[model samples]
Target: MKTAVALTIAGSDSGGGAGIQADLKTFAFNYVHGASVVTCLTAQNTKEVTEVMAVSPNMVKAQFEAVINDIKVDALKTGMLFNQEIISTVADCIKSWGGDNIVIDPVMVSRTGAQLIDDSAVEVMKRELFPQALVLTPNIYEAQLLSCMSIHCLEDMKQAAAKIYDLGAKTVLIKGGAAEGKNKGIDVFFDGQGYTIVGIKAIDTVNNHGTGCSLGAGITAHLALGKSLPRAIASAKEYVTTALEYSLEIGSGCGPIGHFFPLIESQYNG
Candidate 1:
């Protein structure tokens, strides 16, 4: 039997915590083959992103065509679509290739407080890419930007989730990772009919450099493996929580969650 394949169209995180690194790791964890089309490259460490260089829109298109023409993608997700042109390019590619299950991670800002996306691209994403999304996952900050609603509390979260759903996404996962530290990490998933809150006690780990990318990738991985939307997201949160728990200290500043920790544990402990 062949392993199902998933593609991640995102940037390359030289720090190895996020972007293509996280997506590829998450796909492997979920027992799927992973491929990538780099959208940009960043000079980033756990502490800060010093620089970014986006791929040409034409190059992006070429890469996508090269992959799909050769391999079948069971599921796909996008992250860090920086500018309006790239946003338009990717949106067109998705439609032209006839995408399968797609998870859109509205990545606006980085964990280090750096801006990974352009202000103008946000509108293009909503108008072009989001309507075709199977599931849209946004962290609290991104949710606020998308819905124009301040999410200071859980009630605000439910409202934000509903509004984002109305924004044309078939489903929305508004990750509650940034509420007051006293509150747990509760990610809310709202489909058209109802909602669910998958909560995990906040892990006080500085090695959480790529939580957003990891979660979105994990969710896409589950979808590729035949899980329903709800199951995929719930399972993804669990996967990231475990990754955070076993996270390692690598860089001088922050660090990365171990995507293959489970595999490492199994190999060493057994």
Candidate 2:
């Protein structure tokens, strides 16, 4: 039997908790073969991100060509394209290759309220990349930015999801993990027709550094394994929730969710 293949085009996290590392771990946990195209490198830990450097557009394009040329990627996801040039380069590569089952995790703002991408990059992402996405997953902060509205309730999330869906994503998932009150952990999914509210039990943890990236990669892996878009989203949500439940307490600050939680559990169970 052939293993399903999934690709991640994102940044490198020195902390090994997010970006390409997290995406690969999530893909592996889903039983998919993972490929990667690194667009940037970050000197970051659970504590803070100190520095970041984007790969040149030429190198980013080269990486994409090398990966997609040999491997048959059943699905792919993008995360943390830090600049306009990288975003445009990736978009062109996706167009040249084929945009099928592409999950775009708009990594504009961090969970710590820091902006990761510049405004120009955001514009390029929406204009060049979003329309090609099969699924666009944005956290509450990113959703607010994309939709130009504040999200404080489920209704607000729904509206934001709808508004973002208009921007050309076939489906939009507005993650409400950072929401307050009764809306926390309740995500709104909009697929141009109606809305579905996806909610899971909230896990209280400061170790959620890679939740967004992992979720997007999980969905891509599921898609590679032949699940429908909505089904993939549902499965990814469950995977992230479980991973969060077993989040690792590493470093002096916010840790990361356990992408390989099942394997870690088996070490103890056995």
Candidate 3:
């Protein structure tokens, strides 16, 4: 039996479609094992997040040690490091043992537009963790937040990605879901040298709750299975597109894309 295990170091979303939930689902659907170290706990429903309490740095470190000692991680995905200490702790651990493929999703704002990270942790993530990531996946808002610049156009996205690269990430994926353009849901990928502009048509449904988390985890799964960076990212984007296409409207505000929608709800049916 061939089993691959990937670890997610992120927060828990009570809504069950994002965060640890979505990561685990993506892992299972991709035929990989999933483990997790929760960095924070959020009091969130389908509509919005009410409160978030970040776990202590010691606990975070302990969780990593436990995972490392028990099972070797094939790949790693990180999301929602809410504070400076937690971010620092994760970065240090990654630096110590970060040989495997790693995808860092800089989760800045929630689907409801609530801030999930502290302002103090931004600098720490840039200096400590971004350099260690195999790929840093930051959405339009997150890119703007990290680079401290307004993203008005695709050019702004490129500039933001370059600025983020200066902070140390080997590669930066600046998502263009919210970029100023006719694009309904196009995302851009940029390394230090050049950039690739990819266009994706919008999914008609409103169930886009955990698309970001699912995308990061899906990409990590492909990388763990030995896919190149570009291929892994392109494939992951396609996976998210299908999930969103079959998204189920669970909440009034915005719902979650089905991570296993391809299997659960066939594209033709749902």
Best by lDDT: 2
lDDT score for candidate 3 against the true structure: 0.83
lDDT tens digits by residue: candidate 3, 1-270: 667788899999998988999999988888788989999999887777789888999999999989988987888989998898899999888877757598999887654445666777777887788878889998888887888898778788888888888877788887765554475577778888899876667776667888889989989888877789898888888888888877877767777887877577555576
Tens-place lDDT per residue, model 1, 199-261, is 876888878878889899998999988898888888889999989888879978879888998
Looking at model 3, report the run of 10 residues with the lowest lDDT sum.
175-184
Decide which is better by lDDT, 1 or 3: 1
Candidate with the greatest TM-score versus the true structure: 2
Q: Look at candidate 1 and tell me the lDDT of residue 139.
A: 86
| TM-score, cand. 3 | 0.93
Least lDDT summed over 10 consecutive residues: which range in candidate 2? 110-119
Off by over 4 Å in 1: 112-115
Runs in model 3 lying further than 4 Å from the true structure = 111-114, 266-270
lDDT of 2 at 20: 99
- What are the Cα lDDT values of the candidates? 0.87, 0.91, 0.83
* Candidate 2 residue lDDT tens string, 1-270: 999999999999999999999999999999999999999999999998899998999999999999888988999999999899999999999898885889999999987667877888899999999999998999999998999998777888889999999999899998877887778778889999889988888888888889889989999999999999989989999999999999999999999999999998999899
Model 3 pairs whose backbones collide: none
Candidate 2: regions farther than 4 A off = none
